[model samples]
Each structure stands twice: as structure tokens, then as C-alpha cells.
Target: MVIATMFDHRVADGYSANMFVSSWADITRSQPPSFLPSFRRSVLNARRPTIYTPSTANMFISLSKLPLIQVDQKNEPNLDQDSLRSRIYYIKGDQLKKLQLLASENGCQRSKLESFTSFLWKITAKYMEDSGYLDHVCNIAVAVDGRRRLSEGEGVEKEDLMAAHFGNVLSIPFGRIHSKDLKDMPLTSVAKEVNKLLKTAANKDHFLDLIDWVEDQRPKPLMSRPFAGTEKAVSIMVSSGQRFSIMDKMDFGWGKLVFGSCYAPAARRDYYVMTMSSPVKTDDWIVYMHLPKKHLNYMETHASHLFKPLTTDYLKLYD
Candidate 1:
């Protein structure tokens, strides 16, 4: 029972698309949908006073303040749509656990996704430094779902109501550091940085402020702050699909799902990574990556032990 879904990034993000797939699978199995789709716009209505903070402004940028395109990209080649590539890999459970341990050694509990994000951030920084962009800014962002966080203290009913709400209820909190500084940071320090960035958005106030910010900038285009600046920057977005539960919950009377993973079109030149649970190995992960060729090559060469290529042998598809 393998299923594929495609979404336009302009309309919906990965979280909203995954919710739709989960709900669709539940209905197909004759089970009550876990999340009933809610299209009410009032759920995310802007505040009357339109209050926002500097943190909200830092997360996103209005189109008006964008600087003119720089023509001095001598070492950096133009990354056209054709240059983007997609690859899939399987990460062993033990490796993930080791990363988690290393990331949490500072006494702060770090999730698996946070640990992995830290590792990738370091790798990206190294690549940038190797490419002679040591002083350039490198940013990594994690997509945080705001449903539960936004409804905190409102009671379970309100939380469930927000859970059932359909749309992009997401906030991207990112870390911006110089490639030289980030590359020199230890894994634990990098993980702490990742955790600190996540804390900025993992609360109710942040999302509320974001809603108000969007309202204040209504009718004008907005983009993530990392992508808006004219300074040399390399950005990547990491999303988690561990909660999708597709392998365990998406049975449509045919059989359990053998293998499933997301895909991105090569024409889309965005650097993104998604971590999903493996269908065969409960603890393992199937990483779907849309990154630059150089970055993927670096990962393959430097971190091959952690990222094994996905193949028929691992999935037991032929057997």
C-alpha cells in the first residue's frame, strides 16, 4: 500500500500536505479520521491591535526592503532549477541514537530530529568553508508545527480543534551563523544552537506574534528572512515526518505499507530534507533529500556510515 502525493509549495507546506494524506488514509481504512479538515479562516485571525515583536520581524522579511540582485557571485555558480537533485537514504537506528546522545550530552534533552539537524548544519558549514566561503552566512531552519503549541493552556478540546484545523500552521525558526564559526563548533554546541533556535518558536506567543506580523504585512509578499538578505547565504529547511504514522496506520484493506517516502521535483531548486520512519525497520529513518550536488557529495563522502543508500535489498522488495 504505497502512495505518492504531490503538493504545490506555494499553496501548502509539508505539514499540511502530510495531514491531508493521513486523513485520506484513515477514511480509506473505514476508520474515523484522526484530523478532520477545518477550513475556517477565523482560526488564525489577526489580533485587533496588530501587535508584533522584533523576533517576529526577524523570522520573515517584507518584499519591499529586499536589495537589488548582486552580480558578484564569482565563485558561486548560478543554481538554476536544473542543478537541484533528489536522493533517498536509510539511516540506521543506532546511528540516530548515537547522534541523539551526543547532542544531549550538555544536559538539555534534544530530539532525534534536532540532533540530525545539528549534524547536517555542521556538514553544510564545512562544505561552505571548503568552497572558500568561510565568512558567508549559513542558515538552517526547522519547520515547527504550531497547532499544539498555539493552543497551550486552552484545554484539550481547543488543542484538538487546532489539530483538526487544516492549513499551514507552521513557523520556521532558523539559526544564522558564519560558516567558519559553525564549522568550528562542536557537535554538542551545534545541537545547543539548534535547540535554542527551536525554543524561539515552540511557544504560543511566537505564533501569535507571527499571525499579527503577517496581518500587518497583508497584501505584500513575504519571504523567510534568511532568503531575503543580499549577503551571501546558504539555507536549508529540515522537516520531520516521524508522526505521520503512514506505515502503521495507512492500511486500506490491501496490506501494510511496504515502503513510502516523499519526493521533490528537480525543477524546484530549494534545499530541503525530510526524515520519515522506515516501514521495515521501526527505528530506522528514510531520509528524502533535495539538496545541491556538492552538498550531497560531501555527505556521501564524509558521512557515508550514517547515510546508506536506499535500495531494493534493504526494502526486501524482490523477496
Candidate 2:
């Protein structure tokens, strides 16, 4: 059996999906959910005297202000709307360790997310190079959930049921590098750049600015950097699922959930990557990627070992 859910991205970001499911499960069992959700926007209000950090201002303004990029006909993917696709890939703990070791050897201390982002960024830039778009930009948007950051700053303790705090509390900070530089730069260096971009939004002020910035764009749409670029441009976003409570944690009293993943809507032109822990093997991860077929084909052809395809046998669904 399979279950699917749909939520308005503007209203509920990825993290909210878990709470929504858990709440439904609680009702089914005739038990009150551990905590209810709060949809208060004022909780994220900016300081009384409006202050703008340059970085925060740039992040919120540049994307919305930039003109939409246009791609010529030759660079377009050779696929009709119906032919768009998505794939599931798995990465072992050992593989991640190897990459980490490689980074350390190069005098870099990179986390799993940074390492993967750097590696994928290089791979994507390679595709651009191969397609004769060496000067084109390749950006990686890292999705950061602001719930923990906001709560901690607001003096909300760990034991506090933040289940009540709900809305689109998310900040997307991304890194952009042209294909030419990505090709010439080392993996560690590229990852370092990506790490730096992510750090810019890892604070209380940035999120508060994000909230106020959204308010400023009231009647207008907030277009992220990825969405502002052209179809040919490589704009991939990775939403970290390092702490997603799935599997045994999602038990609705019937039994533990055997497996879980995302449900992508119709056609998506840009790339999106998400990762979760492996239930069977500790330290391993299951990656879900939705991207252009050409990019997937290139990765599958060149780096197949790094991304294992999911199968019923591997997951032991029937066992």
C-alpha cells in the first residue's frame, strides 16, 4: 500500500509534512497529538527598528530583483512535458566516509551535505561544460529549516512542544559558481564556497530578516535564485532530511512504517535532492533526486557506484 499527500508550498514547507501525517495518525488512534500547530506569522517579526544586514538584504533582494534569464533554443532539453522524470538513489555510509577522507586529505573539513553538494556541483558544471556552456552559472540552493534556530533564539527549550509552531519557516541560502571556475577548482575549494553561503543564513538575524523581507514583497512573488535562472541553467536545491523522523518513529500503533519518501508533483524543471537515514543499515542514506533526464543520465553513466538504485529486494519490502 502507498500513501501520498499534497501541501501548498507557500503555506507548508517540507518539515510540516511530518507533523501533518503524525496528527492524522493520532486522530485515527483516538489519541490527542503530542502538540498542536500554531500558524502565527507575528512570531517571526523583525526588530522594532528595522535594521538590514547587507548579506540578508542581498539574499532577499537579488533573487526578486534580477531579471529572469533566457536560454536559446539549442540548449533546451530534448524532452516533451510528459517525458520529465525523477529517480531514487542510495549512498552508503562508507562512500560518504571516503569522500570525507578525500576532503580531509585536501586540507578541507567538509560535512556530508557540503561534500555532496560540492561533488554534485562539480558534476553539474561538467554537464554545462560538455554542452558548451562553460560560462553558464550552476547554483545549489540549500534549504534550511528555521524552526530550531528560531525556537532556540526565542528561548523555546528542547522539551517545549514546538509542534504548535508551524508555518513556512524556511530560509534558502545558495551558492553560485560558473562552470569554468567549477571545472578548474578543486572539490574542497568548491565545497568551501558552498559551506560559506550556507553559513550566511545560520543565525537569528538572517531568519528575522527573511520574515520581514517576505512581508516587504507582500503583493509580489518571492522568486528564489534557482527559479530566476533560465531552463538551461543548473539550479538544484537540497533539503536536508538528516533529522527526519520516519520509519519506527512514525508508528500509528499498528506497527512501524516500513519506508517513506517524498511525493513530487507534476513536471519540475529544476533539480531537487533530499536524503534520509537508512532503516536497515545505520549511517547509510537514501537520496531522492528530481532533475533533468540529461543530468541524471550523465551521473548514472559516470558515477553509478555512488548512487545505488532502490529495489524491493534491497529494501526487503515483503520480508
The CA lDDT of each predicted structure is 0.84, 0.73
Of the candidates shown, which would achieve the greatest TM-score relative to the real structure?
A: 1
Candidate 2 all-Cα RMSD: 2.8
lDDT of 1 by residue, 1-319 (tens): 3468788765776667767887787788888876677777887998899888898788988889898875666766453335678999999999999989988874677899999999999989998887666567889999999988888999988887787777778898999989889998989999999989999999999999999988888889888877665777888989898887666666656777777777887666668899999988888999999987877888999999999999999988884
Model 1 lowest lDDT segment of ten: 73-82
Deviation in Å, model 2, residue 235 alpha carbon: 0.5
**Model 1's lDDT to the true fold?**
0.84
Residue by residue across 69-159, what tens digits does model 2's lDDT show? 5656676654333544688877888998877665553455788888888888888888778756656778888988877766664454531
In model 1, how large is the Cα lDDT of residue 121? 95
